[model samples]
Structure formats: structure tokens, C-alpha cells
Target: MSQPLTAVSLSGVTKDFGRVRAVRGVDLELQQGEVVAFLGPNGAGKTTTIDMILGLSKPTSGEVRVLGIEPRAAIARGLVAAVMQTGGLLKDLTVRETVEYTRSLFVDTKPTDEVLATAGITEIADRKVAKCSGGEQQRLRFAMALLSDPALLLLDEPTTGMDVEGRRAFWQSIRQDAKKGRTVLFATHYLEEADQYADRIVLVSHGTIVADGTGSQIKSLASGRVVRVTWENADTEAITRLGGVDDVEVRGDQVYIHAKDSDTVAKYLLTQTSARDLEITAKGLEDAFLSLTGTTDSTDSTHSTEGAQS
Candidate 1:
């Protein structure tokens, strides 16, 4: 078969507000059936970029295409939908009303009852929008976004005010929706959310795409292991002297060792010291983000890696 169609594409894309540049030469391609996490720190131009993708803002230069068409045309055909971070709901409307109004805008739409159920808003369907909590409002927006039954969904901080259980349920709904061959691209501050849920991660900083890959591959960018142990006195000096030990920190009775070869460090602790509660874990996405964004000054530049397994 020919190569799969591109669901979204960006090439040499840049955006500026007055004299302040918000996006810088960002390039990305999103294929169908992929769940991607667009990640960055505050003011990294994530919202601005999303605006361009949704045809809400014009790019200063370069191209953006959704399903082989400009975003406006694609959106008008019910090919795209977005659940933004805030400010879309009408305070006077009820959850059911909100969904119904949105459905009226689309020629073809999912049923409001189905949207309410899937979005977990059935219990509050008749409640006025202004009385709903932030998390509840989020679900209402989610219900509205689903009305179009779009091929792609864009979620910006989609779980901001949810409790732990609510967040879990929300993501579960997203997972089930993705089984239908729909694409999802979400921007979130919760790195662990990206780690566990996303099939691919795109890291941006300074208004540029810095890293794009699976969670495992991105974490591999900051290669190392953490050896955490509870010990009497910690033998801080001896652990620091061990081979492959890059750094050491001690808190109370516990010691955290950063090691390039954790096996060597683990061996020493097992045999030499009264080390207890030892745990070794590979560095995660947070470390990788810090490393790529200049904390550890990782050498990897803007790059994309496929075929990464969990």
C-alpha cells in the first residue's frame, strides 16, 4: 500500500506577535491513529501553535495542513475539533444545552445523549454551566467537542481541575475513543500524564520543537539510573567514590545516587554498606525534558525517533 495519509503537517512554521516571536521554525507531521502529547513549559508558545493548527491564528510564515486541507476547510467539514483549556462555555447554559448548541453547528454529529454519557456528564446534564466546577466544565467542553465526530481531537490541558479518579476516568474515555481510528494531540503540564498515556511525545522549548519520540526514547536522551537507598549514615563519601557515580544527595537517613552504571553502585551498596530499601529506576520523562532543555545540556537537538516501545 502507499504511505499512510498525514493527518496534520507543519513545515518551517513560525509565528510572531508584534516583535516578540512565539514560534520558531517548528516542523512536525502527525499520522492518523497516533496519540501525541505536545509538551512544554509555560510561555513555550503551545497555545499559539494550537491556535494556528485550529485556524484561529495565522502563522507568520510556512505551512499548516490538516488532512491535506487548510485547517479552516478541514474544520468546516467536521474533520477537526478541539477541547481547549478554558473560556468556551456559556455560563447560562446547562450541560445538555451546551452540547445541543454545538450539535446544531455541525451537519453530521454524534448524539447528545451519547456525548453526555461518554463525557461523564449525564448526572449533571441539566445543571447550569456556571454552577459546574472546573472539572465538570471540562467534561462539558469535551462533550461539545465530540459532537462533530471529528477525525482529530486537540486537547489543551484537558484535565486541569480533576481529582485523581476523575482524571483517570477522563483518560480512559479518551483511550476508548482512540480505538475508532481517531487521532489525538494533547498539551499538558503533567509530564507523567504524557508518559503513561501518549504514544508519541513532542517536546518544545524556546518556541521550537526540541524532541519528539516515544516516552522511552525521550527518557533515553538523558541516559542514567537512580539508585535510592535507605542506610545508616549513607556512607556518602564512599558512594561518591564508586565508579559511574555522577552525583550524590543525602536527605535524613536516605541517599539518592545518580549513576551512569547503577549496577556497579548497587553492588557496592549490597556488599559494603548496611544499605536497605534499595531501589533502582531509570530516569523518566521529566529528567529527559530538563536534559534536553539545558539543565544537563543534552547534546540531542530537534529530533524524532519512531519504533520506541514502552
Candidate 2:
């Protein structure tokens, strides 16, 4: 059998703007038909990397290929499409008209009705774009993107203004499309969505790829448990001095302790300190994100300016 094609590939990719380096030397690859989540905090070069892949911006160094060809070439052939967070909509047109207008820009296109239904916006096709809610408008954008029947779909914060039901429906459409051999790459602030939806998660921090794995595997990288207890007299400094403790936070009477040896911390909290109602749980994706990205630290100046253009 022939080898599966690579949908997107970045080798030694780096991007810089003046005095600041936005993206460090990064390498990534996504196989065809994979649903991958590209995750990072603000100024992490996630958007910059996406721009390079779309051929909207050139990398200061390295190569970006889409479908084994140049990014722009693949895009020009209607093999790749992107649904951005905002803009590209005409308020004066109805949803159907918006899609039809977009279709006109292409040499060949999927049926407008089919795209609308696939995007779950067929029922609102007659609604005026200006009158549509944010979620509805985003669905209209999805419909517009699907008009090309793209093999690789890049979604940048695709569900930003959507409600709970709207997000659910939107992802359902993406899942169905991915099942049909369409590759989907999305960036979102909602970590739960990535945990639930993505086949794999790629985490970038300070313009570099830090963690790449399944949600569970990423969580394991945190390597600790969080112990929560109600202790009015908890001393943060004292807790930090503990052998296994990594960090501690006190919120009102609730004290949260992150520790590698959770058993020892729990025992000490129950027997030594006035801490009560102790609960110990494994670190979650949020914990891993904060730990791996150094989001809680104020030391990295790179993030402060790297995403200025993002």
C-alpha cells in the first residue's frame, strides 16, 4: 500500500519581527484525516505559525508544506481552507447569499445547500447576516469555508462567540467531516474541547513546542496531585518548604497544595495542620498547561512581545 500523505508539515520553522522572535525553531507534522488541536497561551506563536501555514506570512526560516506542496499552491488549488474568528462577512447579504458569493470566487465548489446542511446552518440560510447571532454567524462562516470541500481545514478560534449548544453542533459537523477523510486543525482557548475532540494535542509555549500527546498523556507530564483543604491558618511559606510540595495557594479558608508525594502531603494536612475536608485529585489539563507553559510565572519576556502582531 502507498504511504499516507502528510496534510501539513513544518520543519525548523522560525518567525521573527524586528527585535522580537515570535516563533522559535519548531517542527510539526499532521497526517491526512487527523483531528489535531494546536494549543498555546497568548503570545505563544500559535497564530503566527498558522499564518505561515496559510501562506499569509513567510517564515524567517524553514519550510511549510501543505499536501506535499507549497502552502499557497495547495490553497490556490482549493485543497486548504480556513475559518477565522472574525471578518469576511457581508452584513447586507443573507447567509445563503454570503455562501453563494464565496462560491463565485472558486473555479469549482460544493453545492451551497450541501455545505449549509453540513455546517448545520441550512435552517438559517434565509436569515440576514446582520440579524444573525454571533453563533449563527460563525456557522455561516463554517458554511462558507466548506464551499470549497477542502481537504485540510484550519479553524482559528472557530467557536469563540458560540453558546454551549452552538459549540456542540459546530464540533459535531467537524467530527463528521473528519470521518470523511478531511483533516481538521483548530486552535481554541477552551481546553476541554481539545481534550474531548482532538485525536492529539500539540501544546506550544514561549514560541516552542513543549508538549504533544493525548490529553491523558499531557496531564501526566504535570507529574503531581492537587490537595485541597479548608485551613484558615495555613501558612503558604511553611507549606512550600515541605519536601514533596511544588506550590501552594490560599484562597479564603481554602488551601490548595500541589505535591508530587500527595500521600505525605495529605497525611501532614490531616494530622499536623488544622487543615480539614482534605481532597486529593490528580492534575488536570489546566494544571499541565500552567505547569508546562509557565503561565503562572512572570519571568519570560519573550511572550510579552512575540504575539504583538497576532
Structural similarity to truth (TM-score) of each candidate: 0.76, 0.83
Show where candidate 1 strays beyond 4 Å.
Answer: 225-283, 295-310
Candidate 2 residue spans exceeding 4 A from truth: 120-128, 226-258, 264-281, 298-307
lDDT of 1 by residue, 235-260 (tens): 78888887878789888888899899
* Candidate-wise lDDT, in order: 0.83, 0.87
- The weakest ten consecutive residues by lDDT in model 1 span 301-310
Give each prediction's root-mean-square deviation over alpha carbons.
7.4, 3.8
RMSD from true fold, candidate 2: 3.8
Per-structure clash totals for the candidates: 0, 0
- Per residue, candidate 2 scores C-alpha lDDT tens digits across 37-126 of 998887788888999999999999999999899998998888888998877799999999999988988878988888888778888899
Residue 83 of model 2: what lDDT? 90
**Winning model by TM-score:** 2
For model 2, give the 10-residue run with minimal summed lDDT: 298-307
Please list all clashing residue pairs in model 2, or write none if there are none: none
